[model samples]
Target: MNTYFITGIGTDVGKTVVAAIVTEAMQADYWKPVQAGELQHTDTHSVEELISNSKSVMHEHSYALRTPMSPHAAAAIDGVHIDLEMIEEPETENHLVIEGAGGLLVPLNEQETILDLIKNNYKVIVVSRHYLGSINHTLLTLSELRSRGLEVSGIIFNGKAHPTTEHIIKKMGHVEEIGRIDEEAVIDKQVIKKYAEMFKPRLEAL
Candidate 1:
């Protein structure tokens, strides 16, 4: 079975959109360890609904904190502790995609960060935007992953407005230029597939 952990440089960077696309492509099961700020039309629900394959199972946090803050702060506001034990692992499946709450350093509890919850057995995918300072944030994130001895698949640049010269400068490992998302608010399946194919090698390498 193949397992993947999806994280981003920051919030609203299309991690969930890319996660949904991968689930749809591989017909894999999906799990969101912690979900904060869930509204009527949420990314988690949208992903669960869009992926039509009956084989995929979507699992979310038992306590859906209402605040649009970090998981630790949100849980504290609700008088609850963010417990990793509460996060259930998916049943034996061919592929499992675990989506992080926010970025890599987002606190899950007082001591544990999102990276702590991630299983080393899974390949990590960092999702970031093509805006300014992205290169720095992406590199920092990659460094952290390397420090943790985690395997990074590659990066997915979401919501790219215009091409930048950093694309050439940031070429490190087997990097792929995943297509951009024009509309930041909506999730486009085609864009997901375009990027998903770029992630194919890393996914297959696992």
Candidate 2:
């Protein structure tokens, strides 16, 4: 079974949307691992709403903190300690999609970051949104993953494309452009399904 770790350059980069699309595309089991905020409308809930496939299973989060902050900070505010040992990956026969919080270096605890949860065999998928200095952020994100000897499957560009910025990122980052999620006013299941169909081929090719 293939495991895909969905991460982003930073927060609000559409990691959850891309994760839902990938899960719908592959009909894979979905796991968020760690959720910091939006407990009433968590990433798991969002993905569950977007998914149309009946085969996909939504695995519970290892840690669901209440405060809308970094996992470590959120845990602290909640009077809880984030422990890496306690965050065990769920076993599944189908493909698994794991979503990370914030970015690669987002701390889960004093000793470990979100990157620690990624195992050697997991394929990393990065979600990048174009903005001022995004090229730098995107490059740095890819560089960090590669430096840690992680296998980055490719990148999913979110929102409108910036030709020059994307050009430089693709050329320098040395990562395939899995697909882009165009700016959508309303991203319903139909919209997600549309992108899922569009991204299915490339994701399967991975």
Q: How badly does each model clash, as a count of residue pairs?
A: 0, 0
Shift of residue 26 alpha carbon in model 1, Å: 0.6
Each prediction's whole-model lDDT (CA): 0.73, 0.94
Pairs of residues at least 3 apart in sequence or in different chains that clash in candidate 2? none
What's the C-alpha lDDT at position 116 in model 1? 86
Off by over 4 Å in 2: none
lDDT of 2: 0.94
Q: What TM-score would every model get versus the actual structure?
A: 0.84, 0.98
Worst 10 contiguous positions by lDDT, candidate 2: 160-169
Q: Which candidate achieves the best TM-score against the true structure? A: 2
Top of the candidates by lDDT: 2
lDDT of 1 by residue, 1-206 (tens): 78878898888787888888778767788877677786565666877866666788776555588888998999899899987787777675479888887789999788988988777788677787766777777778887888898877666666645455346525753355433445545546655555556655555655
Quote the positional error of residue 192 for candidate 1 in Å. Answer: 4.6
Question: Model 1, which residues run further than 4 Å from truth?
Answer: 161-202
Clashing pairs in 1: none
